[model samples]
Target: MTNHWLFWGFWVMANALASFMWGSIVLSATPAAFAGMLLGIVVFILVYGTLDAYLIKQNLSRWHDALRRSVYIKAGLQLMNVFLAFGWPASPELWAGIISVGITQDRLGIAQNHYPFGFALLNTLLTGAILSLMVAALTAIIFFIRKKHESR
Candidate 1:
């Protein structure tokens, strides 16, 4: 907390590592889904980092509170992503948002031979949901440990 840069540095590094790992798993399935990988990392850092900061500033009064809120947000986003991927034609604007980040539908479409849209959608959603839960649990454990240490 005393060193702000250190906190941000660690945060960015951790986020990047998670993004790449997820990217790798995604690529393994689709192979030609490079655009998705890039979009996932960039959007995650920009969107999630900004939202997390704002939530901490406005709603979260403590570190643990922010982490808890983040868990909910991440889980919700994964569900939303699933819906966006599956119901892309219904809510077409979702593609715009994703494309704005540089991942075109054509790129995703190219992998249809190996990974159909539905298959990719389900795989991404399932993996993201599981990872989000794991991260949330880890955050909760860290929060409790820090609280306990401070209390003692």
Candidate 2:
């Protein structure tokens, strides 16, 4: 915790790595979708693993400040997933993001084999938001679990 570089560096790395790999990790549809969702949760945990540790280390009366800071870090990290559209190997599977929401199609017309910048950007934002909410819930759950354990 004393080493600022180490803390922030790992935090970024973990989130980036998760975002970079999240889309590609989903295998298929139907019954397998459940497994894929489970895998997605795993990725969220990977992103949040260090964050939870870092927040626990801070031991402040209010964890909201740390949560806010982490969401910003996550959003920034999501930007790197732009490569997803170029078939960078991590493109999100959400091929139908609403254009009005600033997300274009996963790619242009078939045979074109290209992805809109907005597609990746929207996926990035959506996932980042989901991750923030999920991790916040996780943080709370973890806090209560820890409190209960400590009381014992």
Candidate 3:
């Protein structure tokens, strides 16, 4: 249970860091604007990470057992994760947009600028999916190492 919490906590922290850095780099956000962005991102990460971690942890037990017995199943699962990665982006993007409204108004004192929803959506989805796939690839490498170690 503690480990589960820790896992999710780290995941949330990593996400928060990524969001903050990305926002800073792309938007050249002021400190206050970045704070607002970070606040929204942290909220999204907390909620999403907790739920995702719970599901993954539960499913991982079964996966681990099966993976230990069959390389084919392990490879297949990793392949599916490439698609599962697509589901991760929308919530954070939505939450960030919503939260940024208040933050921009209050802190930046900037008038809200309208962005086309479709363009933003497509951008977020593509970036998120690509990042997620990168993570999946790293995970596959770790699994490979573990498998190799176990066989020795």
Candidate 4:
């Protein structure tokens, strides 16, 4: 991360690849260059925004240990989604394999099926963002209440 060349190279390569993939998805599904680029930008922003927030939170944890617990709680709850997808699964390894393939198909293997990748990806991205925002707001509310109670 300290190496400037390496850092910028990562972003440049990522955006270029994203642009090409999104452009292809857009052109094939809807034939709109403008929409494809916009979609790329939107996807980039959503992903980097989350990453930046995560990085900042990690940096803050250098002094504030509670932040680490909150992150663990957040992640544990997030991990529940995959396990819950199986509804009390008895086998962890089987569930992990099934979830990996399911996610892979959701992202890449939609051509043979009726659901195209573009619309499905866009729908899921927006839905996930909305749900994430709601979770952040709720966490903030709980944090404020805890701070208030601790100050008493």
| Candidate 2 per-residue C-alpha lDDT over 53-151 given as tens digits, one digit per residue, 9 for 90 to 100 | 675687753464445464455446456467767867433223212221232233433111233333344444555555566446655666566667779
lDDT of each: 0.46, 0.46, 0.45, 0.44
What TM-score against the true fold does each predicted structure earn? Answer: 0.43, 0.39, 0.41, 0.36
The candidate scoring highest on TM-score is 1
Cα deviation of 14, candidate 3, in Å: 2.2
Clashes of 3: 0
Supply the global lDDT for candidate 2.
0.46
Q: Count the backbone clashes (under 3 Å) in each candidate.
A: 0, 0, 0, 0
Candidate 1 C-alpha lDDT tens digits along 56-129 = 66765456464654554433443343454565543222333334223323543434345544433433343334
lDDT over C-alpha atoms for residue 138 of model 2: 53
Q: What lDDT is obtained when candidate 3 is compared to the true structure? A: 0.45
For candidate 1, the lDDT comes to 0.46
lDDT by residue (32-146, candidate 3, tens digit) is 4455554554454455455555546788653343332332332233343234368744433234434554454456455423332322233333334444444445556666777
Candidate 4, residues 1-152, lDDT tens digits: the string is 34533433344234334224433543345434345345544564446445545656677532233333343343344344356456865332233334433553566564313443443444334433443454455556666766788799
The full ranking of all candidates by TM-score, starting with the best, is 1, 3, 2, 4
